[model samples]
Target: MTRFAQAVAESTRSVPVPRRPDTGRTRVTWRQRLGRDRVLVLVALPGIASLVLFHYLPLLGNVIAFKDYVPYIGILESEWVGLANFAVIVNGDPLFLNALGNTVIITLLQVLVVFPAPIALALLLNSLMSERIKRVVQSVLYLPHFLSWVIVVAIFQYMLGDAGLLNNFMRDYDLGTVSIIGNPEAFKALVTGQVLWKDAGWATILFLAALARIDNTLYEASAVDGAGRARQLWHVTLPGLRSLIILLLILRLGDSLSVGFEQIVLQRETYGADAAEVLDTYVYYNGILAGEWGSSAAVGMVKGLVGLLLVLGANKLAHRFGERGIYQS
Candidate 1:
C-alpha cells in the first residue's frame, strides 16, 4: 500500500496541473495598477475623441483636394481631377506666395522676439522678492490674454488709427503722426507688438513653473562660492531651466507657420491682404469666398504636411541638443 501510494504521488508530480483559463482580464489588471493614470485616460477621452472627430477624421476630406468638390454634388459625386487642383494652387494662385511669405516672416519675428520675452519676464518675476508685487504685475500682464482678437484689434485701432489717440496727440503737438498700425511697412512690428501685449504674460506661466522647479540649494551654493546675483542666475537658474526652454523653443518652431489667424483676418481688409493675409486667411478667401475648394484644400493639405515635417525635424534637432523635445527619449 505504501509503494502504491508512492507511485501515485510520483505520477501526480509528473503530471502538470490543468492550466487555468485566462479570463482576458490582464489588461484590466494593468489598468488597475495604473490607478490615478486611469483617471487621466478618462479625462483625456473627450479631448482625444474631439481630435479624432474634428482633426484626424477630417483627413478623409483631403480627397476633395483631388476632385472638383461641389456642395450640391458632394465629395463622393465630385469629378476626380488628380493633380489639377494642386497645380492651380501651386502655379496659378499669385496670392499663395504673398500669404505664405507674410506668414513665414511674421512667424519668424514672433519666434525671435515674442517667444523670448516670456522667458525673460518669468526670470525677472522669479528674481523678485515681493510676492504681492509679483502677483499684481502678473495680474495686470495677464489681462490682455483673455481679450478677444476683435477687442484687441479695436484697442489697437483706438490707439493708433488715423484719427485715434496717437494721431490726436500728434495733431495737438503739431508733430507728424506716425503710421504704426495701418502702414504696410509697419505691419510686422504692429503684429509682433500685439502678440507681445496679448500672449507674452500667459506664455510666462510655463517658464515660471520651470523656474520654480529649479533647486534652491544651487542658488545657495552659488552664493557660498561668492557668486553674485547675476552670476547665480546665469550659472544656476538659466542652466536649470535649459531643458524647459529648449522644449518650448522646439514646440514654437513646430508651430512656426501658425503665428496668428484671427488677428490677421480681422485687420486683413484694413491693411489690404498684402500685409495681413496668412495661410489661414488665404484658405478663407481662396477656398470659401472664391469657391475654389479643391485648390484651397490642396494648400491646406500642403501646410499640414509641412507642419508635420517641421515638428518631426524640430524634435530631432532638440534631441540633438541633449534636450527632450515634445516627447522624452
Candidate 2:
C-alpha cells in the first residue's frame, strides 16, 4: 500500500468508533412537518384545480382563431382557415381599425394621466401628520374602489346626463349646459375620469406600501442637508419607489389593449360604435352578437400577442436603465 493508505489504516486501528445516536425522533419530526405541508397543499387543491379546469383548459379554445369555427360542428370538424381570419382583421375590417385606434388612444391617455394620479395621491397621504385624518381620507378613497362599475356609471349619468343634476343647475342659472357623456369628442376624457373615480384610490395601495417601505433615515438625512419637502420627495421618495413604479408601468403596458372593455361595452350604444368600440367591445359585438367567432378570436389573439410583446419590451427597457423589472435578471 501507499504511505497515505498505510497512515489511514493505522489511524483507523487506533481509534474507537462512536455509536450513532438514534435518529427515529428526528425522522418522526420530519414526517410531521411533511404531513403538515401535505395538509396545506390539500387545502389549496380546490383553487389549484379550478385554475387548471377553467383558466388553462379554456386556452385550447384559442385554436378557433385559426379555424373556420362553427358551434354545431365542434373544433375537430371545423375546417382550417389558416391566416384568413387574421388577414380579414388586418386588411378588410374598417371597424377593426377604428376599434384599434380607440383602444390605443384610451390606453395612452390613461397611462399618461390617470396612472400617475394614484402615485401622487399616495405620496400626499404619506406626508400627512395626523393619523386620524389620514385614516379617514384612506377610507373615503377606498370606498369608491368597491363600488360596481354599474353603480359608478349610474352615478355619472345622474350627474352628467341631459336634464340631470349639472345640466338642470346650469339651466336654472341660465348658464350653458355641457354634454359630457354622449359626446364622442369627450369620450376619452370621460372614460379617464371614470377610471380615476373608480380605481385611483385602490391603485394607491401599492404605491403607499412602497412608500412605507422607504428608509425614514433618507428623509432625515435630506432634512439635515437643507432639503425642502419638495426636494426630498423628488430626490428621496421618488427614487425609493422607482422600481415599483416601473414594475406597475410595465404591467399597465401589458394590459394596454384591455383598456375600458366593460365601460366601452356599456356606453357603446350611447356614443355609437365609432366612438366607443374598443377591441374587447368589438370582439363581443362581432363574436357574440354577429356570430363571427373566428374573426373575433383572431382579434383577441392579436391583442394578447401584442400585449405580451409590449411587456417583454418594457421589461427589457427597465433592465437597460439598471432597475429590476417585474422579473429578476
Candidate 3:
C-alpha cells in the first residue's frame, strides 16, 4: 500500500459510520404496553368494566324492539314480531306524535337559544378583571347544576305556580297573577329557561377552560394592532374557541332527542302529557307504566338510530368546515 492509500484508510477509519435505522424491529405488542403501564391499566379497569356492563351490555336489550316483550316471560322467551311494532309509530299514535312534537320543539329551543348562553356567559366571566368576583359568581351559577331535577322543578313551582311566590306578591299588591307553570303554550319556553338556569353555568366550565387555553400573546398582539375589545373578541377569541364550540354542538345534536326525562316526568302531572311529555317520558309511560313494552322499545330504538345519524351528519358538516369535530375522520 502506498502513502496515499494509507492516508485514505486512516481517514476512513477516523470517520464515524451511521448505523442502519431499525425499520425491521418488531412493534411493541399491546400486551407488553399494558404490562409496562399496569398501574394505569388497573386504574382504568373499573371504568372499562362499567362501560361494558352498563352501556354495551344493555345494547342487547334493544332486541326487545322486535319482540312482544313480557316482563314475566323475559326477553329470551318473548315472541318475535318483526316490524309490526314500528307500524304503530308510522301510523302515528296521537300520544306518541304529541310527545315527539314536544320533544322536537324543546330540543330546537335549547339548541337555537339556550346553546349559546353558556358561551356568552363564559365570555363575560372571562373578561372580568376581578378574580374574586368571578369565582363568587361562578359558584352561585354552578350551584343549580348540583340541584336535582325534582328540586329544580319544585323551586320553579314555588316561584311561578299559581299562589306561589310571584303570584302571592302580585296578589298582595293587587296585580294580576301570572299562570306559567302549567301553561302548554309556554312549556317549551319554560323548559328552555329551566335548562339554561340550571345547567348553563356548569356548561360554561368547558368554554372557560377553552378560553383559558387561548394564547394571551394573541390578545396582546391584537391590542398592539389597535384592535378594540369587540374586534379582539371577534378576531381572536371566537376563532380560538371554534373547535370546542363545534365539538359540543355535535354532542348536543347527538342528544337532541333526550330532553330531560326526570324533569319532564316530574312536571307531567302539573302540565299534562300534552305539554310536558317527551320521548323519554313516553317510553316510561308506555313501557313501564302501561306495559306496552314492545312498542316503547321500538320507538326508543328509532330515537337512538336518529340520534346516531344526527351525530354522523353533524360531524360530516364539521369536517366540511375544516373542524376535527367530536372525532377525527
Candidate 4:
C-alpha cells in the first residue's frame, strides 16, 4: 500500500462519531413524586381529609336508608328493613308528598328564572366602558352573597313583613297592607327573589371571567363586518360563553333538588310545613326533630340518585349536540 493511502485511511478512522442526545424523560415513581412534592401534598392533605370525612365517609351511612335506623342500635347494628322506608314516599305520605311538590316547584323556579340572571348581569356589566363604575356595582352586588341566609332572610322580613317597612309605609298613606312574609301563596316567589338577590352577583363572577377570556379580535371582526352591539354579542359573546354556560347548567341541574336547607328551615316554622316544606327541611324535621332516621335517609338517598341522573342525562344531551359537557365522553 502507498504511504498517502495509508495516511488517508488513518485520518478517516480518527473522525469523531456523533453521539445521540440524552433527551428522554425519566418516569417518576409515586413515592419519589410524593417526596419531591411533599410540601404541596401536605398542603392538599386537609382538603383530602375533609372530602374523606364529610363526603365519602358519609356515603357508608347511606345504608341506613335500607335499615330501621335506631340511634341506640347504632348504624351497623340497625336492623335491615329492605325497602320499607322508601315505601312511605311511594305510597304517598301526605307530608312527604307536600315536601316533594314544594321542592320541585322551588327548584324549577330557581333554575328557570334565577339561573339566567347572572349571565345577563355579567353581560350588562361587561358592556360598561368605565371599570370604576363596574367594580362599584359588582362590589355592591357581591356583598349580599357573603351574608348568611339568616341575615338575608331577616333583611327581607324587615322590608316585606306585614308589620315591617312596607306595611308601615302603607299605613302612613292609608293604603291597605300587603301580606307577604309568611304568606304561603307567595312563598315560592319570595324564595326565588331572595336567592337572586343573594347569589346572582356572586354567580356573575364566573360568567364575567368567561366573558373576559373571549377574544377581543372577534368583537372587532364582527364590527368590521358591519355588525352592531347586539349582533356582536349574539355571534361572538354568546358563542364564547357557550361551553361555560352549558357546564354551569349541567351542574345546576345536578343540584336542583337541593333548594336551600337553612333558608327553608328558618321559614318553615312561620309559613307552616304545608307551605314552606321542601325535601331538605322534611329530612331535617323527620330525621333530627322527629327521629324517623330511616325514612329521612331514604328520601335523601332518592334525592341524591335523582340529582346524579339529572347530571348524567344533561351531560349526555350536551355530548349528543357535539359539545363537551361536564367531562369528556
lDDT of each: 0.87, 0.90, 0.93, 0.93
Candidate 1 lDDT by residue in tens digits, 9-48: 9999998565436853333455556784888888999999
CA shift at 215, candidate 1, in angstroms? 0.5
Once model 3 is optimally superposed onto the true structure by TM-score, how far is the C-alpha of residue 30 displaced, in angstroms?
1.4
Per-residue alpha-carbon lDDT of model 3 for 199-268, expressed as tens digits? 9999999999999999999999999999999999999999999999999999999999999998888888
Cα displacement (angstroms), candidate 1, residue 325, comes to 1.0
Q: For model 1, what is the alpha-carbon lDDT of residue 230?
A: 88
Weakest lDDT window of 10 consecutive positions for candidate 1: 23-32
Candidate 2 C-alpha lDDT tens digits along 190-217: 9999999889998999999999899999
* Better candidate by lDDT, 1 or 4: 4
lDDT of 2: 0.90
Evaluate model 4: give its TM-score: 0.91
Q: Residues 1-329, candidate 4, lDDT per residue (tens digit)?
A: 99999999999889844444574556567898999999999999999999999999999999999999999879889899999999878999999999999999999999888999999999999989999999999999999999999999999999999879999999999998999898899899999999999999999999999999999999899899999998998999999999999999999999989999999888888888898999999899889899999999999999999999999999999999888999987
Clashes of each: 0, 0, 0, 0
Q: What are the runs in model 3 whose C-alpha is more than 4 Å off?
A: 1-26
